[model samples]
Target: MSEQTGKQMSKEEKDARFEAELLPVLDPLYNFAYRLTLDEDDANDLVQETYLKAYRFFDYFEQGTNAKAWLFRILKNSFINEFRKKSKQPAKVDYSEVEGYYNTEDVEGESGVATTTDMRTESVQDLIGDEVASALNALPVDFRTVIILCDLEGFTYEEMAKILDIPIGTVRSRLHRARNSLKEKLEKYAKSMGYNGE
Candidate 1:
């Protein structure tokens, strides 16, 4: 039913529908949020914001449809909006950088390359997790979102297109490039970590 044409739901009805439909997707929502934010507090805030918007616009939501996908779309949009706003703010200096600089100056000469023991002998699998995550995180937002939606969230290409509001062909091409880029990144680490493509 079209949102404006349907008989308006009562507050209790809306609450019941939300609980029955949207609440069950909470974990998936948080996982998506956490992957995007990489911070527990920020993920929580993103999920909360998504739910608030979902609830506020629940009437427009079609019942018996893919609720999880619906919630994901909301969360994805919210994340993008939050990210844009955060990007507009002045950048902050992380304390970790300051500490690292001091430690580097004390241990190694200020001008020369800092020499350290090489762990290149480590197995690719041991190092690939962090490497893969970094590569995934390094992706552009549009590419990253498609990867997350398709590979991570197990959405079909059609579903990903819908969630991303892009054409299906666009989704196909973006995912292809994203995977190729991620593979190149992982292969670089694999070679460094002593993997010989076996």
Candidate 2:
């Protein structure tokens, strides 16, 4: 790879750093995706698409820069684009009934136990994690995004602005509003748990 001097680099060297550096950020990418989409399948697909796009455009990436931030920008853009495109489409028809018909023999195999997992395994909010997650999930996507970027990812306002493609002032404003909204949500949860706002 180039020596951070904006010099030319060989493809092998680029590939080496691309894998070495970018792969480490995959967990954070997936976590960010999950927080954005709130669906495991969607998050997984978003992460996959981000990686593919990033790899295809690796030549444009500067060496010795903040790879995580770069990767995050790509992921956030991908999520927005993909989700927006999906929102514009009509609802899809699921074919689970036909699939289930074919799986009947497997479902009835051996002990014939019911395959469905019990939702009661986890209480609403599950005391803390679920409560916090539900509150976060309830937030508007824009506010949830600021929380994930600024608070969760620990990005500075300037860094967040660059990643989010917004002005630093806008980043600060959004972060303020988002935090306030999240606090209100958590306060409700705390009240439910007898916290009394202490």
Candidate 3:
């Protein structure tokens, strides 16, 4: 049914449908938001904003469709909008935090390294996981998003195209380049860790 027809749904029915279809994907939505924002508060705000928009325009959603993809599209758009809005503003700094850090005895010379316990060799799996995450996060937003959507989320190219609002061919090319960029990053780390692909 079209949105106009769907709008005729009773409020209770609408609420029930939303609860069943959308609420189940909350964890995945939050994961995506966290990856994009890399900040818990921002991710929570993004998810909240996405849900608000989705509920407000729930009429536009077609039942018996991929609700996850619909929600993801809304979230991706919200993130992009928020990013653009923030980009236009001057950056904010917390002088108190900087001052407190500098006042601490742990402060070393010009190098910003802290004298914390070494975590590099604590756990092999955790180190690898952290390296992978760092490599993924280092990618540009467009590249990082394609990797998250296709590789991490397991969305088909068609679904990713729809979620990203790009042509299918563009999705393919972007995914290719993103993977290559990620590979290069991981390879550098691997070499540093003495794994020369031998």
Candidate 4:
């Protein structure tokens, strides 16, 4: 839009560009949000808030940059702000989870559907994926986040550093410790599946 930039985009052009560049990252962004909050509703809210803030401050976003990283940074900040606010209040339980537990009858009952474990012989990958997800989720938020950003999302150390607003060294340290923690968590599952520590 600036004359000096040699490219002038109208409002419609900007909107189109924004959608073209940013929309594709929505799912990954939502995945990151879910991993952070561990709640579908919270993740949706976080993603919505991220888009709103990104759109509001679109002018500050430098074009041709890593839009995903930018959106992640915004989402991380929002999650932190929300976390702080929630921490101040008394903890609230999700009654629906309790109610569902009580109401459900033999969750794996008469329905002939096979669960991840049940189909392990046919798809070891699916079972391992579930184990990995469970192990990953067991990690503290900071550790889980580093693993998600680095290993899962495939962000480089530098990009993760920027997204997390930490030094590259800290990112590396955190990721290293996070991986060790995850490995420890998954070791039992791995051994059970015939993967000895050797």
C-alpha RMSD between model 4 and the true structure = 6.7
Q: Each model's TM-score, in the order given?
A: 0.75, 0.75, 0.80, 0.78
Write model 3 residue lDDT over 1-198, tens digit each, in one string. Answer: 335464388878889999999999999999999888767887898999999999999888999899999999999999987754764534533333443454353223422222112345466677678868867876777888999998788999999999999999999999999999888777766655556778
Q: Which pairs clash in the backbone of model 4?
A: none
lDDT of 1 by residue, 17-122 (tens): 9999999999989988877776688789899999999999898899999999999988888877775576454563333345345434543343222212223565
Ranking 2 against 3 by lDDT, winner? 3
Off by over 4 Å in 3: 1-7, 86-121
What local lDDT does model 1 show for residue 198? Answer: 90
lDDT of every predicted structure (CA atoms):
0.75, 0.75, 0.80, 0.80
3 or 4, which is superior by TM-score? 3
* Model 4 lowest lDDT segment of ten: 103-112
On TM-score, the leading prediction is: 3
Which pairs clash inside model 2?
Answer: 125-131
- How many Å off is the CA of 170 in candidate 3? 0.5
List residue ranges in candidate 2 displaced over 4 A: 1-8, 87-126
Model 2 scores a TM of: 0.75
